[model samples]
Target: MLSILEKFDIFGVPIKLKTIKKQEQFKSSQSGVIAIIIMILSLAYFFYVISLWINGKLIPKVTTSQRMIDYTTYEWENSEISFTLYDIRSKINPFTKENNIIMPVLLEISGLIISAYPRLLFSTLQVDGDKNVITIDKGKLVLSQVDGSKEDDQEDIKQYFVFFTKCRQDWMEEGGYCADQQTIDDYFSTNHGLLFLSINLQQYNYETLEFDEIKKTQFFAFEEKSPFYSQVVLQKQQTTIDDGILFSNFKTFEVIKDYEVNTQAVSAKFAQDTVITVDNIQLEFESLGAFIFRIDNIQANETILMPKLGEVLAQIGSIVNIIMLLKILSNMINTAMLESTILHQIIEIYYPQFQHVQITKNFLGQIKQVHYKGVEIKLANFQHKYNQLLEIARTKFTFNNLIQEISRVQLVLINQIGIQNIKNIFKIEEDLKFFESDRLSNSNHQIQNLVSVLPEESPKKSEFERFELFNSEFPS
Candidate 1:
């Protein structure tokens, strides 16, 4: 077992267990403190690393990069835009003393007029004068027709406008509200009517096979002094996150609104290929008294969230390497000190004259020479004696010789008694009757002098006599 164990060397060189014990005891008072310090530091750093790893600090770092792309590249044809208007203006009814609010009655887009009705899908409408909401589904936009005939001229940019009006008296009467012209004028002028516009822009997500809506709310106020116009620019943004092995993609549309008030009537032509005039304040029955907006241009922003596994590994590996280096350095120092101490002890054991000798060491803490009785002895001489002692210590008594002797005795016993008789002898019980009779006889005798039974002169028997006596007992 010892021979097999000696063959296993972890550090390229096998060290004796005795040498390690000597190092532990040599200058133990000082070395113990240093060992304790090293142990504390190593354990602290080890636990610190374990805690960081447990807390996910060892995971890959996240990185993000953003860029812009053309609107044509984006899938805008499948996207939809929704508009929701809320009337927050207070209009007290003369009869019931309740508030009356007006909502959009018609939606005009590209010379086509469509009835304005609540087309909300997710939420209910609140019309208690607090949150009177009117939802309109605008559907999808035709970008190619709005951009123009020539693809190259699309860079010049054109806007598409949609108008919502609430001026019709019949539409107001249907809602059980006042249909008089004076009531309509007073609602617009005295109340300074405010409309909460919620624009929901939706983008199609190819990954989820669904549409994600991004909603923006703006407040538009109608005053007798000036007209308020809110211009909104729709921009598309896509984001991707690297989730370990796969990436998660999300698409969302962003609405950017620019509000301006024109004191005079402004003429803004917003159509596919024709122009239309816009008035500052619409008292006329044919004018759009509600909100007006146009889609200006489209811009795309792409952001990517990436994980840096290599950098994380490098940082963790660097810390582990520093700790391992410290451990290896400490082991090397201990090994060197152990070797020097072992050599000195071996030299003292071989030569009693060197017991009081002073050993000199170099800066590296290696034994350079030994000084004794005004004479200097080189470490090479001591090393030679140490090697001789090691050889003597390695010489062990072989168990093979003992095993051979046992085998010979077993063969002799087998030949004298036959294998079957040997087995029977082992199985037989001992006879205690002779032992009992002998004990009784000895008790009855009670010899006074114990020296009388001592032999005066005895003749030694030779090997032949002993063999004859053995043969007589066995008798083949």
Candidate 2:
């Protein structure tokens, strides 16, 4: 209530003290109860009106502000590891116009935290080319380890948030996993054009930073002509060597590859070798955790890499889920409004605080071509500008909790670029509360239909009203 009162001042003029005194004087009367009820209803109505106004009036005003591509859709991994995230943007099918998805993102993931030197982190597989084979590439290391001790292991994830994940959303809105036969095989490593982030990440900085000083550094955007290109990081497996057929990074954990062990292998210069090569035990314990998996060779004593604990669990779980999903799929079963990885297909969208809104994209898309006999609401009326409105809505209205790295990096970017001049009327807390209740995995979230709800006379009617001019102001 106090917070609500604080927000009312943003409307500019306050109610006079005389009115307040008069209202207090009438507090004990029978009419006061009715007045209070009226006041509450009015307040509620105001919020509803505001929601419509923001969607209707303000959204339409910002057209070209919307269509920016969101290549880096999701992120995971802690701040200590050296992670380079990669993504691919291409048509899923050359023949079909709509099989395109930006990147099949890994919205929800959990892996082991302990560092393994020279061992490949459990990674997302990348496409080799336009073809399906995955690739392994390189990038930078952020926030250098001060003591340089790879031994500093973190048992707990240092508070990372999961966003835009079907799994998380399913768990939240529907109150459990979507128990359809949609198995893991239909999902993981396939022709599905996935975006893989070799999440050796310790710091996930999706936002631009602002700084007090002119902190100079070489940085480039993801735009073309930008030197840094998004590269694919392949899942760790075998690689043939100059000498003979050798395993890449061997792990007995999540994966098993059969190979000949150089029984003469002295595993001491461990960095040079792949697996327990010397013909010793049947299988070597490459690493430790809850379970151990091994690769059996037709030949004896071949070495294999030990995979991390979390990867192993996720892999096995994936295999099980695939088997189950295949069975369900064969039955010609549909989940019937269950959770879906394919949210791009969900039409009847759930919107904020409005309840189970049966709004889907195709339904809305069809609504435009729709002609009404009773009322004169034609989607064609606002089709052109309204499309732009939705495009601008893609520019994520981020409300990042001021993490230290975020604060530092943001200060460098936002401050350096004079982003402070932007006067935001809404409180960070208030906007964050609204975002949490609205945009995320809330059961009520609707795919924001940013169609024009404002008249032509509105200030926001302009295409790019809210955003500042381009950084073309940079030194030439």
Candidate 3:
């Protein structure tokens, strides 16, 4: 507590301590609350952004389904079916003993039958893992009626059994002939129990004998009128010849099971000697099992749901908001640091004192009161004292007595506070010098010794001697 007579001022400026403390506390609390609220709002926005990303990935309901069509045409006269035979275990044809000629039989049939007919047969079949297709070595001929039923064998349909090799044009006229029993046996052999058969149903032009327009084949369609095509597969079968002396391992050739043929409903029309009709067809897929189907006739309608461009941009802008929040926090911390430093410096400006006073007897005994007190006078009471403190802060200490109190305090307080903070509190200038007490004492002792060398009292001098000494010292 300060006496009413004691001056309370800093650097000639009066301060209302109670009012400053109240106002500063209010400001600090408000600042802290505002900063916390801003940080919470920023964190909420960040969580909102993260939630958007989570919803985009975890929710499958956001996807949309659409209807589509495929407007593709099949030319009956242009389409073809090909049969290729491969020896699986050997690079050489088993019968011919030729290297790199494993394909012993190559049969291709082109006309209206392959295009219009739904069912065709190959006698022997195997699957090629590398090519991902079923191969047919030799095959019986079978035809399907327009009503999706099989027709009984007829002589004319049997004559259609031909070995048509496009690579060997000179084999016969019309690219092939009917194969005899000997020819079939000589070419196809399963000695190694490994044989492969592959057949491909595709569209080509017979008149031009060249490829027709390559249109997109539909794997699926929206309308039931569209034709769905499926790739054929090989089912296991066995054939023994001469009581197992020679046996052929074969898999029956079949298209994908449970596949529906919708081409029966399509109307076939002849125009300019070419069969033309718009139909949806499915191409058999091997690995994925499910097809990304095509829609026939009508274009697909698609709907997509996504965050708007502005929303995405706003989410990105949250990063900037976070940066600004951090900046605000940093500024608040810096202001707090600066205020604390200033407060400490103001308190340190007052020299603290400890005094012993006699106190009235307590319940136990009479007590000695130890009072801790700060400087009694302020700048207004004794302006010179404040000036002295400021001078001491800015200047070097030349004498040991001048530095005793501050030196001891500095050493004691160094461990309790940061050096920078302590220096700031004391308003210590960089130019101020410090000396070790031992060194200062040694210097003082040396000075005392030099002084002691001088005589205790100066000899009495006459007026004439004093005049002569003055003339020698100063010739005037």
Clashes of each: 0, 45, 16
Output the better candidate (2/3) by lDDT.
Answer: 3
Which parts of model 2 are misplaced by more than 4 Å? 1-319, 323-376, 399-476
lDDT string for model 3 (1-476, tens) is 57543566444645545434555332444456667776777777667665654444311112323333212111223222233333344443222211111212221222222223222222232324333122232343322222433434321221021211112222223423334445434443433232222223322222332224432222222121232222232111111111111242222222211111232222111111221112333212111011111112222222222344355557658675765666576567557544543433543543221111112324322232311232122223233433454465434333564487678777756644446555554553322436666555556544543344235342334422322211232222
- Name the candidate that leads on TM-score: 1
Q: Which stretches of candidate 3 lie over 4 Å from their true place?
A: 1-62, 68-87, 90-183, 186-315, 319-325, 348-476
For all predicted structures, in order, the TM-scores are 0.42, 0.13, 0.25
Candidate scoring better on TM-score of 2 and 3: 3
Residue 339 of model 3, lDDT score: 51
Output the number of the lDDT-best candidate. 1
TM-score of 3: 0.25
lDDT of 2 by residue, 339-444 (tens): 1211312211211211221323341134223222232233443344334434433332223433554777756544433453222212123324556545455332
Q: How far off is residue 3 in model 1, in Å?
A: 23
Clashes of 2: 45
lDDT of 1 by residue, 1-476 (tens): 98788678555654535434554234433355556766676677667655664454443333333444333322233223334333344534221112233334333334232223322121134434433344444343322353336465443222334434333334443334534667757765664455455555554333343446666556554443443334445544344434342334433434222223222333222211222233222223232333434343344443333234444455556776675566555666666665556555654554454566676767566568766555555567555654565454333123675577689877866765457655655544333436876656554333422222235332333422332211233222
Lowest lDDT 10-residue stretch of candidate 1: 267-276
Model 3 accuracy (lDDT, Cα): 0.32
- By summed lDDT, the worst window of 10 consecutive residues in model 2 runs over 286-295
